[model samples]
Target chain A: MSAERYNRQIILKGFGEEAQQQLLRAKVLVIGAGGLGCPALQYLAAAGIGHIGLVDDDTISLSNLHRQILFTTADIGKLKVEVAAKRLQEMNTQIGIIRHPIRLQKNNILDILSRYDYILDGTDNFESRYLINDACALLNKPLIFAAVSGFEGQLAVFNTPDHLTPSTNYRDLFPIPPDKGEVANCAENGVLGVLPGILGTMAAAETIKLIAKIGQPLTNKILSYNLLTQEQYTIKISHGGGYTLPKTVDEFLNMDYQDTSEGPQGYAEIDASELVKLQQLESTILIDVRERHEVPILDKQIFTQVPMSEFGAFMSKEFYQKHVVLICQHGIRSVAAAEAMQEKYGDAKKIYSLKGGIVKWRDHFLKP
Target chain B: MKIELISFGKISEFINNQNIEVDGIADTDTFKQYLENQFPALKSMKYKLALNKNIVQENTEITNNAIIAIMPPFSGG
Candidate 1:
């Protein structure tokens, strides 16, 4: 009968038939199918989650195959949604899937998310993470989030609708963004083959735990996993950090939503390029907050490259050390890097990520 | 000490031949004020500012030692 479908999971003391059935009936939406989303979607669909929504707006890149396991070599150049949907459909034909092939923008997210009960965030950068958090916050939906950097991975859930437990978001975790050149990303810093595998599996675990109402959710806790040592630790987020979450999607998208506890002015930032050549020479440390693997790194001898993930472990001093210039694959990680460093460093100036990142640099200085 | 500015990628026409400076503005003035005095068009350009190398808001005070750089909000992924 149906008992055989979930025989193993149902054997758990607390997660018996009822929990399995709960998972079978739950509707979960997994946004992003890259590194983190790949594994998260696999387990949920395999577990026969009643209805699943797979959303993404990307194509298969030769670069993605290292961690994105859903696609094969022949699947290259195909739409991610098309390929991912095909794979999920095969995983569990009995389950329902609502495929969204478009990028997860604020406009389309609400309607798509209104019907789902649980949301999983496997996105890499901060913009999507913030948009997802704000949208779910206002909608009062339960969200499971997981992000990994080098050896570190973080997981949490935000349920703003729950009156008793106001959720903590990425903003709450790192109140201010890091300056440019303060952090690194998997794209630039080489991620071990199993890093995303380890993290994505954790995300899948959290999704099911939330759906099945199991023993405990990573709801109020921030779980950090270090693959280098196989050590996992959890930090409880405190409330009331004076950060006012954005009220509307526009507010979130306007790029004005800032976390500024670290800067002398907090999240307030300036363009590093505006400082004239003489100014840069006078008093500033132009640190590049990108991973070393990013090709054609910035050429200025004045600039230093420090990956964002490792920034937390370094920088034991105050913020605004030497007018840092953070950069990354694009600008998303740099913004997150800025906020993370800003929140942690807590005060100084001369820290700004390149507005468009090194790609802009490549186009400007070295472009053909 | 004066704050100098430069840009890459796509350059706006306003960038050329403009030697803009605001007098009586110390390094301690917030970058937003610097924009108000130097590039009036940039005031509404919706750009972000930074000293040394970090992004800063409009009201941040200018510091003599700060290396101010003005740029736009990040949109690329």
Candidate 2:
């Protein structure tokens, strides 16, 4: 292949031959093989980026075919990274493609991410978004970040400082995540099909700007788009007062998500397994606070019947006489109920929630 | 007291055309209060309040000549 493909872009005075070669020598890792990732990966591969890393744990579900442009209908139910690399390889084998089939976790993110020069975030979940930001902040790597929901999308560059630019990061814009449930994914509220396409293309443009060093980048300002009306707006952002270089990725990782949980807070008490044994000696009452229709059914007659919704306003503190154990499916609602009881009853009745719920107890405690 | 209040993004569009005066403009605190009064939505959104390019949080003392910029997070691409 000749340099003719990039010749037009390279001839521009600022990004001439040197920047084109930089593009040929750079490696980029993209997380999330969903809607955003597909478009971002497509343009980067077409632009002759040097090496690309595709990390995703999801399989190509039939529902994703609408926006994840890389896969075919037949590719549904197949591993995303594997098939994505194959398609990308078929497009341009000259660009080295490494597919990591594992989910991005705190333990493996550092070792795996250390290899790439630039990162593009396409993740849809907060846990993964935090991991990406923490890893990038710790590694001092330039990140082209983008997120989309409904008819809106945001694009920005984090930690990329050039000769004339000052350092800026995600926290400079949003010091913390919104309360959980404030922003719902497209799955719940619905999104225009073309939203991610516009955002991902801008993300690709930003990546080239960061590498080419030619155009103005969205460093301290965030560009917001409403594709429904073809409207565009931008907001200027500056560093927050408490912003500082994070000591370790762990320090950044430990930054608590700013109250994004918008649902009702139900608390339950999960207790040590031995407490149930001692309670048996003390004749403790056990309450099953789950609805009768959840998975992992238990056969113990020690259980009491009480659905979470009805548990309150129906059963009084008199129901739980001394120490009581609360159980539920996955331990979410039941523990919440136990905490409510603890608040009402206080030290008069000791309430403990079984951790990991009944399934955990069956596996760890009651195994034959 | 008189002060200029400007809101950007979605919030800006809502208040862009009206030439309105807010009563009880005792201080800058009242300026934000006036905004919250006009658009009930302002109370729900977390905004970066700026006084002539200086970032200010809630409870910031208002100067009579301050030009306040109310900016909200634009999460669109």
Error of 1 at A77 (Å): 0.6
Classify candidate 1 by CAPRI docking class.
incorrect
The local distance difference test score of each candidate is 0.63, 0.68
Q: Write the per-residue lDDT of candidate 2 for residues A1-368, one digit (tens) a residue.
A: 45787778778777778887878788999888788888888988877788999998767755577888899988965788998898888887678999999877766788888999999988766556656776787898888888775666777788776555466677665555444324332224355557787788788888877877767887766666667667665655555654454568676556553322111112223434544574565557777787878655555575666778887764564663576777776565665676577557756766667655664455643555
Off by over 4 Å in 2: A4-15, A162-165, A185-188, A242-245, A249-368, B1-30, B37-45, B49-77
Report fnat for all candidates as fractions from 0 to 1. 0.00, 0.17
Model 1 agreement with the true structure over A178-291: per-residue lDDT tens digits: 444333322344566567777778888988877777757777666656676676655454343535666666665554423321232233233334423524455556556777
In the order shown, the candidates' DockQ scores are: 0.02, 0.26
What TM-score would you give candidate 1 relative to the actual structure? 0.57
Highest TM-score: which candidate? 2
Evaluated at residue B43, the lDDT of candidate 2 is: 77
Model 2 lDDT at residue A229: 62
- Estimate the overall C-alpha local distance difference test score of candidate 1: 0.63
